[model samples]
Target: MRTLHRREAAAALLALPALALGRPAAAQNSRPVRVVVPAAPGGAIDVIGRIYATRLSEKTGSPWVTENRSGANNTVGAAEVARSAPDGKTLLINADIQLMAKRVMRAVPYDPITDFTPVARLATAPLVLVGNPAGTPNGDLGALVAAMKAAPDKFAFANSALGSMGHLSTESFKRRAGLDTLVVSYRGTAPALTDVLAGQTALMVAPLGSALPHLRADRLRAFAVFSPNRSAQAPEIPTTAEAGMPDLQFTLWYGLWGPKGMPAEVVNALNAAVREVGAEPAIRARLTEQGADPVDEDAAGFARFIGTEAERNGRVAQEAGIEPE
Candidate 1:
């Protein structure tokens, strides 16, 4: 009887963790999955997050909702997700801002690497240098560089978020080009684009997808694309190298992450759902049209990629002399 009692106690101890999780398994199926986009509605991250949520919900028979928690260079929403329970319900879908927030900010509320588990890399798109044709003299990279060098603090660069790809990539470009262009931060992409269109800001480095519509409508003109090759959606635009800023190459990438300590099985399921969505013809077509290249990395691969990206972006930030806020 004594031995049986000890065995039963060990079994209970083993089951305690699962019991304490309060339906971690149910999160994958029964409950709604909330994907948190740490930006305003019109940004590239928000656009992709909505697409993924809609497709994943339809594919998996589990409702997925996108919640915008924009502010503080993405920290406000990130911290909220970080502090959430580690069940699969709450997730984060963001861009390179995830890796850059800590490197560019003075006091980050959550650890970009340790506070979350990377679930999968969804897609990557080149950052395009766009200018309002009405404001820019030549509407080309060489002219823009020359203009910045000629007039210090005369031109303003607009960024949707403080630590976003637009911010980091523009800073790096400035450092490399030996230019002193003033950076202007806006609440989100919509406002930033509005200012750019209205000629309030001279230039903006943004995700190709976010700038595509304006470029097509002639509201904004593409100067250079920050990729080794021109994007399929806008092949007429020259690469940064061809446009005379060879070293200013940067790509905007998006991925999914859940709060730290989420179960491996749940992570795997989410990754599989993303892969399935990527395989759909319509989804792939839409992503391609938006200048994104679909990626199908699993959870472990995504984690490793995030680790490397954080290290690389930290080095870039240090090199650019961008002091944390």
Candidate 2:
């Protein structure tokens, strides 16, 4: 009888963890998944994160919550996610900043490439190349290039953040154009656009949504969009390829990630959840309204893209001589 009692006690111990959490561990699907958005509460990133969170909850019949963990240029929240368990319960929804954390800051605690499993790519925000009216009145890409080449010393590019995709895209353009123009970094898009508006800066590669009002008001001249196709919001602007800079294209994108070595099933389940939710017509329309285009790549495909992007970013950083702050 004592032996039987001991066996029963062992069985109870085995059941404790599952019961204590109020759910089984099959999909890590037993409880609410916490999605950490490693940026501020406003802006397209936060809005998109919230939309995904709500949609995932409805589509999966599981609860998902998004928490803002904005700091250290998004590395603080990312490091926290990297240290989390690979249970799929705690996840991260961060921007491309996650890819270049170490390249931009010294205190990054995790390798962006290996420390997390890629779940899905959320969306890509297209960019526009604009010049202050005072600097480039004609808004012609060909003429602007010639002028910049003639007086490269007079041109300065303003990007919102140091390691942002816009900044990297600008650097790539500089190399392709073979001009050594100065790039000035600012805290946010508004201030950078303000400077460009006032002609304190000569040019800026800005998000189409953020720069649309200024462009509509004719405060800034649209030179070319750094995208493969023209944006629906600003169809008048030519793409980089149309402007004769075919090799220069980059975008600010967002992705979901789980800790390293999560069970393959868990990753697939979450990936499916994201895909299902993203496919909803309503969700797609909402994303479009936010100046972002939906992405539809699976986990492995997303990982490969990240590797390619990291390579491109590395080249840009090397060329620009970016040192970690």
Q: How many backbone clashes are present in model 2?
A: 0
Question: For residues 1-325, could you state the per-residue lDDT of candidate 2 as single tens digits?
Answer: 0122444433322322433244434324445778887766654567788988887665454567888876776777888888887777789997776788889888778988899989899888888889988887595788888899999877899877768788888888888888889999765566677889898999998877667778889888999888888889788889999988887888878899988876655666667667766777999898877678778888989999999999988887898777799
Off by over 4 Å in 1: 1-29
Candidate 2, pairs of clashing residues: none
Clashes of each: 0, 0
Candidate 2 runs further than 4 Å off: 1-31, 61-63, 132-138, 143-156, 178-181, 186-202, 217-220
Q: Give the clash total for candidate 1.
A: 0
Instruction: State which candidate has the highest lDDT.
Output: 1
Q: How far is candidate 1 from the true structure (C-alpha RMSD, Å)?
A: 6.2
Candidate 1: tens digits of C-alpha lDDT, residues 1-325: 0122444433322322332343334334355778899888888888878888888776555577889998888888889899987667789998888887766678988888888888889999888989888767665777888877887666789998877778878898888788877899987777888899899998899888888999999999888988999888998999989977777788889999988877666677678778877878999888876778789888899888887888777788788787777
User: What's the residue-level lDDT of 240 in candidate 1?
Assistant: 84
